[model samples]
Target: MRRLFTGLAAGFLLLGTAACGSSDGSGASDAGAASGGTTTLKVGVIPILDVAPVYLGQKQGFYAKRGLKLQLIPAQGGAAIVPGVVSGQFQFGFSNTTSLLVAQSKKLPVKAVANGVASTAEDGADFAGITVKKGSPLTSPKQLAGKKVAVNTLNNICDTSIRESVRKDGGDASKVEFVEMPFDQMPAALAGGQVDAACTPEPALATVKAAGGKSIASNFFDVSPDLTVAMYFTSQQYAQKNPELVKRFQEATIESLKYADSHPDEVREILTTYTKIPDTLLGRLTLPRWPAEPDRASIERLARLAQQDGLFKQSPDLDKLLP
Candidate 1:
């Protein structure tokens, strides 16, 4: 989706670097030491609530103080974003952990350099989880077998962690049917009985709950209390070529994550900039944990679950994939 790039570009004014990220020979995404020696890098990102911290961080001048800035190009999935980073069109990319692991499994040279977002670790109180209609008979994840469940992306973080929740609850995860749809559509889909359940995050989750939907399981929390759902990544080639740049990005991003975690009001306010989430839903929504470090234990657990689910052609090498 080249149009994803153009649409995302049109949504926000280009500011500065894709920082915490990369470099390639052509360096088309790079500004080549502009802004009084500050480098601007283009980052491939999805325009969603999960990415608010980076925007907030940029506005807070965390990146600027580090001589970095962001140019976030929008794309819907890892399929497009990963390739963009590999091709040097985007110096960095933001994606869920599973996509990066799957890329590693397939021998793609993607490397995770910074933490993204995480689960609240509290069942029924998490930002994202498996939800059911208020009056539905399904009260637990174990009852989810042979039922329709919606997720924004199938076979990625949503379904993978959901399966873990199912298995933990003594259900046959493979028998659970995953229906793919956007998070915004899930509230109506659940209320209308179009899907039995949905693995959704806020603000859509907030919408669903307000409409009498009940979260049956904290899937991400079930996987690990510190489940690192998403991350900011770059190509291995770029990391090797420019370790210092990557390090700066990593440090700045962790600082940003810490800042964002502590400043919920600012984070909530920043969500209005890139996304069209309603103020009413925004206040009710659960904010996810934006940790300063990627939980390696949780990631390893994710890799194991992915392997069990046959997501890998071969086992992913965590040593290479994570920084």
Candidate 2:
């Protein structure tokens, strides 16, 4: 569940003008200068379920202990965050594996330092699902033929997973048209009949359902097995320039993941601050485990999905992309 932070806007606005400086701490071997002798880190994120670890790290002060002052930037989408890293606007950001893989294929300087969350198998009772308005003619992927479908972004996880599911369900994915919409607005758009179906992750899925939408498919892993839904990225330049700092960032994130895994109840209590999801919707949502290390095969599969979905023109060398 994503938390709703009332003060988040102020936080982002304040951090935007903050200075970069160096720190005396031992975490990052290659440190950059920031205010108060802290190595500043700018991380990009989309307000969604996969951002639990980021919130955990921030609230728990995991980054601070590593001699890093982390700044969180709420981005438009996973794909939209890539350029921030590539252009040095952010040292690292939370992005889906598919986007990172596609970016790497084009020789973008990026690497997945940590895994965010894994999707469950189909019919696994997870909140991630393909939803349509109640009483809509589209009861399954087969009915979506030649219909207008909605995704948060094309070629990203939302569209890719939906396409794969449709293909497996005897639907011609090529015949379907996709339009971009944010997770928060999916319910309104669906209710307004802007699209036939929406491929979304919760609390959007929950929202659509609460507003009388029917779920046709659930679990992203059922659509594509071992899908690495999201991850944190640092450019090749950032990694090379600050090896110890990147490693420290990774270590802190791993610790936060462990805490989130072990303390789900505590996580739920503070979720409203990061996301607008209500407490009643929390029980239905399933938060997947965060991998301790990045899985190369999953990253490669995302690359292949990107290529299959026409997001990337070529497949990247998976082995060379891993840190």
User: CA RMSD for every model?
Assistant: 5.8, 6.7
Assess each prediction's global lDDT (C-alpha) against the native: 0.80, 0.71
TM-score of 1: 0.86
Give Cα distance to truth, residue 145, candidate 1, Å.
1.6
RMSD, candidate 2, Å = 6.7
Q: Estimate each model's TM-score.
A: 0.86, 0.86
Task: State the displacement of the C-alpha of residue 225, model 2, in Å, after optimal TM-score superposition.
Answer: 3.5
The residue pairs found clashing in candidate 1 are 16-69, 16-70, 17-41, 17-69, 17-70, 18-41, 20-249
Which segments of model 2 are wrong by more than 4 Å? 1-29, 33-36
For model 2, residues 64-181, the per-residue Cα lDDT tens digits are 8877777777876777677666556677888877766766776766777777776653464554788899888787876777888887755677777777778878889788788887
